[model samples]
Target: MPDLGKYADAVLSSYAVSLVLLVALIALSIARSRRVARELHEVEERVKHG
Candidate 1:
């Protein structure tokens, strides 16, 4: 491992922030994809029954 003795707090904080942002982005993308899929399915069903 690298030496993080002098800037340990800064390094840890940076890593934590990056991790939080990445998780947030992934969650958002999954939610949006689910919403779009549901809409598409509904449209397809309407087309088939109409």
Candidate 2:
């Protein structure tokens, strides 16, 4: 936590933006992975039965 002094607002805003983007990316990836996994499980079941 170096003293940002006069540059505090600019630095803080950039950090905030970065944090939001990273969280959004992680959330989307998790959702996509779940969907893909479900589809794969369904395909496997179909093949096993048919």
Candidate 3:
């Protein structure tokens, strides 16, 4: 890595925070997708039976 000089700490911390937030957002989206799919399946089954 190139020397960031005195700004190294600030730049690296910003990258770290951005990566963490990106991962969290992806995780939440996947979880919500699974939940919605499951609920939709249940509703479909209920409608089919009734």
Candidate 4:
């Protein structure tokens, strides 16, 4: 890791927070996508049969 001089703590903490938020966003997006896909599949099945 490069020396961040006197702002090491601040910079590192910011990076950690940003990384956590990014991971959370990705997880939420994937979950929403799966849910939407499942709903679409169900709708399609109903349309096809009924």
Candidate 2: residue 23 lDDT (0-100): 100
Q: Model 1, range 1-50, lDDT digits (tens) per residue?
A: 68899899899999999999999999999999999999999999999999
Candidate scoring better on lDDT of 1 and 2? 2
Model 4: residues >4 Å from true position, as ranges?
A: none
Backbone atom clashes (below 3 Å) for every candidate: 0, 0, 0, 0
In terms of lDDT, the poorest run of 10 residues in model 4 is 1-10
lDDT of 4 by residue, 1-50 (tens): 99899999999999999999999999999999999999999999999999
TM-score of 2: 0.87
All candidates: CA RMSD (Å): 1.1, 1.0, 0.5, 0.7
The models' CA-based lDDT, in order, is 0.97, 0.99, 0.99, 0.99
Colliding pairs, model 1: none
Q: Put down candidate 2 lDDT per residue, 1-50, tens digits, no spaces.
A: 99999999999999999999999999999999999999999999999999
List TM-score per model, in order: 0.87, 0.87, 0.95, 0.93
Choose 3 or 4, whichever is better by TM-score: 3
TM-score of 4: 0.93
Report how far residue 31 has shifted in candidate 2, in Å.
0.7
